[model samples]
Target: MSEFLTWLFATLFVLVVIAWYLTYTAARLDRLHVRLSGTLAALDARLVRRAEAALELANSGLLDGATALILAGAASESLESPAEHGEARETAETELSEALELALTEPVVTHVRDSGPLGQEQLAKLASACTRVQLARRFHNDAVTDVRRVRRKWTIRVFRLAGHTPMPHTIEFDDQMPATLGV
Candidate 1:
């Protein structure tokens, strides 16, 4: 009887420990998800700001009509993209990045910088916006990577600690700064 009681108590103790570990894991995962959510929101805001800055530059008469039109169109498409339209949003952002790379040549950047104080300020704002977008995207992607690492754990999968939470995907878009505007 004494041995049986000892074995029962040990089993209950092990179960309690397992329950505690699972709870801790779930909480950690929940926090990571929340962090990922916040980072995504920040990334979205940075993207919108970047589009707005590009559009403003396009409309400021800094570039030739064709270049300006291309910039404006890409920026408009990015701005109009719905958040839930994941692939479409990514495509629009990629198009904007390509447009910026094509339009902001060294001479064009120099010309805009030398145009006047307002042009210089506008170009600076656009450059800053581009930098912010890059940083925000990196942060968001890092969060996704962290969450994915945790989600791949065997314990998480077997116990379904993540519940119905969808796996987070890293955002992949060309967010490189234009060569001439790397400032």
Candidate 2:
């Protein structure tokens, strides 16, 4: 009888430990999902801010006609891209980055710097927004990677700890900023 009791107690302890582990993992996965959502939201905001800054710079009459047109078109495309069209949005953002790089050439930077306080301020704002976008993208991708790693664990799969949550995807785009901007 004592032997049976010992065996039963041991089984109960093992089950309790497994339950605790599963609960902890599920809670961690939930937190990671929350973090991923927040990071993605921040990334979206930064992208919008970048497009808005580019548009402002384009319309400020600070740049020449041709460059201004290119910048405006790219910025408008990026801003107008629908959330459902993920690939289109990525492509538009990449095009905008390229356009910004080409438009903010040496001569344009020199002119902006020489234009005094307001030009310098606008330039600074645009540069800051671009930098923020890059940082946010990196953070978002990192979070996606972390969540993917956790979700791929055998324990998570066996216990269905992640539930019905859709897998997270990394954001990929050419967010390279112009070196001339000093970002």
Among the numbered candidates, top TM-score falls to 2
TM-score of each: 0.95, 0.96
- List lDDT for all candidates, in order: 0.93, 0.92
Query: Mind giving the per-residue lDDT tens digits that candidate 2 earns over 1-183?
Result: 999999999999999999999999999999999999999999999999999999998998888899999999999999999864278889999999999999999889889878888788889989999999999999999999999999999999998899899899988889988888993
Cand. 1 TM to true fold: 0.95
Task: State the local distance difference test value for candidate 1.
Answer: 0.93
Query: Tens-digit lDDT track for model 1 on 52-135?
Result: 999999999988898899999999999999886378899999999999999888888998999999889888899999999999
Task: Pick out the ten consecutive residues of candidate 1 with the lowest summed lDDT.
Answer: 81-90
Candidate 2 overall lDDT versus native: 0.92
Candidate 2 residue runs with Cα over 4 Å from true position: none
Candidate closest to the true structure, highest lDDT: 1
Error of 2 at 6 (Å): 1.0
